[model samples]
Target: MQSIKNGLVFIAVFIILATSCSKVEDTVIHHPKDPNTTYFPMAIGNYWIYHEFTLEPGGEVPTGKIDSTYIEKDTLINGNLYFVYKSSLSLQWEMIMRDSSSYLVNYLGEIFFHAKSIGDTIFREVNLNPLGDTIFAQYRIMHDGPDQIQLPAGVFSVLDATNVQLFPKAVSGPKERIMNNFYAKDVGLVFRNYFLYGKQHALKLARYHIEK
Candidate 1:
């Protein structure tokens, strides 16, 4: 009886996903400084290979998605220079991010750009997309300096930052989200982990090409 009920639930979710909206939220990352000098380098021709891991709603195992993201070029928006990072997840799907500051902007949302350091806690501005909304983003430096961590991509000393997002009514039973980013100086992001909908998802830098 329990197995039958679970099967029905799975089928229902699959149907919903198959017919879901074609438009996805845009994610924007803004960085005004030279990517070459920042924790993430933004030289054209530079590329990062990322492995995405998504878990089943109630499972601990993960499924992989995505392959590589290349820093193709830079564009001017509102007279502001922004680096473009494009991720071709599949033949039919793509995700792009505009790096302005440490903040990223996408069709999904935007994070306010600013300087950050260790032990700094701040409430920054965020302009999200899809619904085209603005809100405050609260961030904290969970760890700074050198954090030696290992990922499938490689091992590196990283600068870690954490953010907590609250949702009034999220999926099923979740109401909050926690995201942590591990950035490798020069190489950019090494790994990222987040908990959403009571499930854990992650991304790791598998390989990279940085231009001189």
Candidate 2:
């Protein structure tokens, strides 16, 4: 019975995803800064998706929905993106939902970019785990030209998607599934996705967007 319901939920997400608007292209865009320099892509007051992990394994998964919101406050001297946010998980069928309302949270971390000696690889370092108060960080490795950025095709990453990674790994449930849709004027409305299994749940997405 529980499995049936969970499967239905997953199907619903995809159905909505199929019809969601496409990503729009931005002719006026900014390129990434030099690898030697730290770049802050998020601006103060901008809201970004923090993340929601909803994968449950080896048992009946709950019917809780996870959502996130971020407000960029300041960039640290080290070039990390810092922001304030509120996240909520709602178990509509369970009474526990009332006790777990969204709360304000603070995060300070940097997106470290490193240029390797071979193959022109880029490495990103973040604080890592989001649960242990260790600061949240996600990393991505991209293949690039000496002067150009190459990222998986997606609206969320078109501008800065050069090997971008989202942190707080999604292991079991719905969150582990790589399905996304997002829109922005600069990057335009886009569809992006990621999926991971077992250990090394590194996530990546193909860029799809709609632009004028």
Candidate 3:
């Protein structure tokens, strides 16, 4: 009788542990920057706060920096990168006339955002400048589940401001881009740094939910 009782207790403990572990695995956490759209496709028309820039070199590790705080919006028109903002024409003119050897080009373009899957994460990409041979930025937002969007909590911000002045410091005023995503609710959006140089210098930056 004593042996039978001990065996039963051991089996009960094993079941409890297994159940606990399963529960932990099933918990879905939401991110803050997630657009809050999950069932069907969602068109994101809200203004985005442009904050950081990630830099990559030819043969070194990628780095990120926070240089400016500008707000902009993207308009979605028939799945096109369509939107416009003010231009720093004076600066562009100065560069064109004053510095003939300048590699700086004023960026004044639109964005068209779409949804795509990377592994298990649902992300949306915004084409910052989708024309010509211009170097533009892209954003990616991640989701937690089919109906929940997680905010940035454990996400770290890169604080290297010196990078913005590497070249002639090309500025094109405020700009906006249209973003569309199916994971708008679950996954907000994503911003990726593609090392035009190599993958060894690639890095990613994101904004998720934080429990403050």
Q: lDDT winner among the candidates?
A: 1
Clashes of each: 22, 18, 27
lDDT of 1 by residue, 1-212 (tens): 01111211110000000111122222222333232455766677777665666546554354555455666577676666666665454334333455555654543444422235455544344446577643333344444523355555555666665565644433554344455666776677666665544445666666666688
- Backbone clash tally (model 2): 18
TM-score, cand. 1 vs. native: 0.58
Ordering by lDDT? 1, 2, 3
TM-score, one value per model: 0.58, 0.27, 0.24
Judged by TM-score, which candidate is best? 1
Ranking by TM-score: 1, 2, 3
- TM-score, candidate 2, is 0.27
**1-212: candidate 2 lDDT, tens digit per residue:** 11211421221221111112234332333344234322222333322221222344554332232222322234343343344322223222111001011111123222222222213323445563556543434333332222321223321222222333333454534332222222222332122223333311111222223212
**Alpha-carbon deviation at 108 in model 3, angstroms:** 14
Task: Output the lDDT of residue 31, model 1.
Answer: 31
Give candidate 1's error at residue 197 in angstroms.
7.0
lDDT string for model 3 (39-135, tens) is: 1122222121112322223332324432111112334444443322211212122101010121111122211222222222222232234444334
Instruction: Give, for candidate 2, the lowest lDDT window spanning 10 residues.
Output: 95-104
